[model samples]
Target: MSTATHTATRMATSTAGHALGDSLTMLRRNLKHALRYPSLTFAVVVTPVMMLLLFNYAYGSTLGAGIGGGHYIDYVTPGIVLMAATSGALVTAIGICTDMTEGIVNRFRTMAISRSAFLAGHVVGSVIQTMIGLVLVVGTALAMGFRPNAGPVEWLAAAGLLLFLTIALTWISAGIGLVAKTVESASNMPMPLQFLPFIGSAIVPTDSMPTALRWFAEYQPFTPMIETLRGLLLGTGIGTSAWIALAWCTALTLVGYFWSRSVFYRR
Candidate 1:
């Protein structure tokens, strides 16, 4: 190889190594914070469990009868899992906002570390935390008599979809955090995302909603995602919902990734 080519290769390798090491360091920092303050994680886990109980006991029988005599728990579990992931993502926003306001970001900027590493760390760590919350919600659902006939492939697909959604939203939450003036605003900004499931196919069929709400619930991202997950886990017909869900997730992930990068660099 030419000397110029060798030099270029060495530069690329060094940059990649630095990025990896910096990201791992930031990941450990975020993980330590999560461990030190356990209440936030506990709150994220508990909210979905509470929702599961409320829906299953209070509204399950009535709603189950309307949905063709199948157990409501089976129908709603997927949505609740998504909800749990969404709830956990809120913490990413708050954490990022806290870092921004506390001057930590400025210190990082002065260092020679990779600029993107901190955000990457938060995104990866948040996804892992969300998965834990999702497992807890799924376990609770199973104890509440939710059952699925999904084979290994189907289960794997469902897990992939959940992880994709978590990453997409966590990126958006990180952007939201960067723009907020304070941690309180950062926390409040993600409130609408958490409530989206309630308006979609999470608790009841979109058709049962009013005509206007039906239109929204049908077209919104959450419904298609929940439908796709239901199809995978319960063997329901996915039809076009799978494509629509994938499109939404991909579009959102790209948009959030770019938006966060732009905002972070501008600050």
Candidate 2:
């Protein structure tokens, strides 16, 4: 390559490294904040854990039988887990909004750090927090007799899928945070995402829903993810649902990323 081209490549490489390094620094800051003030993380874990117990103990028998006389807890574990992931996404929105309100982004702007690192840090940190919460949720489910037939490879695949879903939701939540004028509004904006599993195949099979609801349940973003996860965990057939779930994850990630970038820069 020419000297000018070589120099340009080196600059790009250095910039990318700085962005990654700065993002990790921000991640540590958020993680430390979560550790010191764990109320929000506890709150995020509580809802899904409560739902799992209520459904598995209070209504698992009926719902389990309704889903074809199998263990309801097994069928619903992935949905609840995904719900936990979505709940964690709320942290990103609130955290981003809090930082913006505190004028932290302005402070970040004055520093010589990468511009994208601000939001990227929140997204990465939130995904890590969410994944940790998911491990707790899964442990709870397992304790409650939510046995899955997934082998090591299957478990790995399921974790991979869950991570991708978490990333997508976190980005979307970050965007919502950027758009919200206040912390309260940011918290409320991501509510639909957290509860979307109910409208999908979370509690029961989509086949059991009424015609219109069933149609939507089959096509919505969450269903495919739930189904794919369920299949992997239960040793059932995944068919093409894995591809569909990835497609949704990709589209959602892109949308959230660009939206967040545009909104953050506009401010």
Candidate 3:
């Protein structure tokens, strides 16, 4: 390679190395913040657990533990994990938005920090926290009679998919948090996103819905994610949902990354 080309390559590597280190440090700090504020962290984790218990108790009979055999609880556990991740990312957005509004973000901007690292760190941190919450929820579900037919490897894949969904949505939420003008707007951004699953396979099978709604229920992103997740967890074939889920995750992550970058530049 030419000297100039080699120099450029080295510069790029140096920048990436520095950025990764900064992201890791920021992530550790945020993780510590979560640990210090146990109540807030506990609240985020508990909401989904409460939701699962409520749904199983109140609507368990009506829903009837779903088609694949075990209690609907087993079938629905993946959806519960998605819901928990969604809920957790919503709070993630609000917290980031608050930091931006209160000048914490600006303070970091002035420091010798990688711009992307700031958000990437939080996104990584949220994924870690979401996984912890998932473990707690799964423990509760096991107690409530949910069992996984899939072996450890498949179970890990199921959890991995849930983590992918969490990371993808957390980035989107972070973008919303970064761009939203007020705390209320940032907080509400995830509400509509959270509601998407209600129309998908999360609560009921798409085939069970009316024709029109079923069409929507079948194609929505959350349906595919949930379907793919169910497939992994239950050792069932969810067909196209697996591919579609990956597509949706990729698309959302790209949109959020680019849009949030633009928002940061504008600010």
Candidate 4:
């Protein structure tokens, strides 16, 4: 190949390598934060389990038909886990905003580090942490008799979907982190995301909701995600909801990523 072509190839490879490296470093830093604040980790890990018990025992009777043709808990566990992932991303955003406020990003900008590495790292770290939380929640469900009818491949597919959802939301959360005027608002940005599930097919069927609310709930992103996840875990067929979920995630990731880049450059 020509020297110019070779140079371009090398530069691309180096850029990709730097991005991956930054992600790893950020993951380590976040993991250290988690280790230092074990209480916080414990709270994030345990809160969903608590939710399961409270919802299942207290309100399970009031809930309608299980989407999975099983107990309500079995149907609701995946949604609860998705909710947990969404809620847990709040801390990740808070951390990013704190770093931004403290001039950590400025310091890194002065260094030889990759421009997008730090942001990429935060996203990667958050996804990993959310997956861990997911495992704990799933294990808790199994212990509580929440069985998945999905085979190994379907289980992997379901896990993959959750991971993608988590990563996609992380980008949106990062945008919130990057643009919030104060740390408080940045930290609370994920609150609305958590509530999305409640109005959707997460807690109850969207058809069961009031007509006005049902219209919004059925069209919202969370409904598709919850329905897709519920179908996978329940070993049901991949339906239109899965396509809708993918589209929503893709749109969110692109919009959030570009918005964040613009904000980051402006700062």
Per-residue lDDT of model 2, residues 1-267, tens digit only: 999999999999999999999988998999899999888788788999999999999998889888788788899899999999899878999999999998988888999998888887888889888999999999999999988988999999999999999999998999999889999999999999999999999999899999999999999999999999999999777789999999999999999888999999999
lDDT of 3 by residue, 177-206 (tens): 887888898878888776678788777778
Q: What is the Cα-based TM-score of model 3?
A: 0.91
Return whichever of 1 and 3 wins on TM-score: 1
RMSD of each: 0.8, 1.2, 2.1, 2.2
Q: Tell me the tens digit of each residue's lDDT in model 4 across 1-267.
A: 999999999999989998778768877888888778665456556877888898888878667344334488877787788888787668667878988998888888888887787887777777777788889888998998898888888788788888888888888888889987778988777788866788887777878778999999999888888888888888655579898988998898898789777888788
Which stretches of model 3 miss by more than 4 angstroms? 1-9, 65-70
* Candidate 1 structure quality by residue, lDDT tens digits, 126-167: 888888888888988898898999999999999999999999
Worst window of 10 by summed lDDT in candidate 3: 61-70
How well does each candidate superpose onto the true structure, as a TM-score? 0.98, 0.96, 0.91, 0.91
Higher-ranked by TM-score: 1 or 4: 1
Query: Which pairs in model 3 have colliding backbones?
Result: 65-72
lDDT of every predicted structure (CA atoms): 0.92, 0.92, 0.81, 0.81
Count of clashing residue pairs in every prediction: 0, 0, 1, 0
159: Cα error in model 4, Å: 0.7
